[model samples]
Target: MSDWKLFTDAACTEEFGGTLTTVHKTNFSDNPQDFVLYFANVAGDPGDNQVLELVEATQPGTNYLTMSIVDANVGSGHEADEITLATTAAGLDTAIAGASLDLGQDDDSIGVIRLLSGVSAAQEIHVRVENAVPNEGTSTELSSAMVEAISRTKSTA
Candidate 1:
């Protein structure tokens, strides 16, 4: 079905099916408040020009995320490729800025900007096309597993 997929980091190696991204808001602001999200068409494929939406899989309260996709690109070569997000508070504010990710580059990549404590990992997130869900919600989840198959992993180490 949909070739697009989601990952926890820019490298796009770790999937979000069973992982947790640390919450980083006001009071619970983690060190690197700016979480990076790179959700593209597929692995190393880059450049499909997609508009992805991420919602708490089950719609929880504690994990409700205010974070959004601040920046994205071919996801291959950039100064911020693997750099830790938000060395400073100002940077974090910039990372989690929007609600949707636009992949107009038409390249292969994967990543995300999510809430940690405010956004609970206990619930499942449904990644789908913009206003075009077939199986779940308004659109179908962006994965190949017939069932929803997204991913996550915020380990700095």
Candidate 2:
């Protein structure tokens, strides 16, 4: 099995909490691969709460990627979060395993590592962050560890 690693890490600013936006993209070779979504950072109003969503790019007229948290079953309405592993064929919404991320006084940031199944030198990957709930949220760019780790694994394989 190809082992995936961390390539990038990102932290969203206060300005990003307003709308959904693309944080960063990893330029990979044109190859089919699987991706694991990791929670790098998280922060919100402790009292009110919020949820963050990670989704895959949709391909018009296709049912893919489900909008659901992995660890926390709470809808995008409270202070909870989740993670999942996704693939180009499957998508982000559909994940195998994930977990909820809670923000503490100092635990305002989370980092996730994705493992690529089969990536070539032509295909690329990107991550999108959406403030599902309303409170306050931010994330760092995909960590270098996360990005480099993935490619390195491919080389060894």
Q: What is the TM-score of each candidate against the true structure?
A: 0.27, 0.23
Q: What is the C-alpha lDDT of each candidate?
A: 0.30, 0.26
lDDT of 1 by residue, 118-152 (tens): 11111222322121112222211121221222233
- Tens digits of per-residue lDDT for model 2, 65-98: 2223322333433222222323333454543334
Measured with C-alpha atoms, the lDDT of residue 139 in candidate 1 is: 15
Pick the lDDT winner: 1
- How many residue pairs clash in model 2? 46
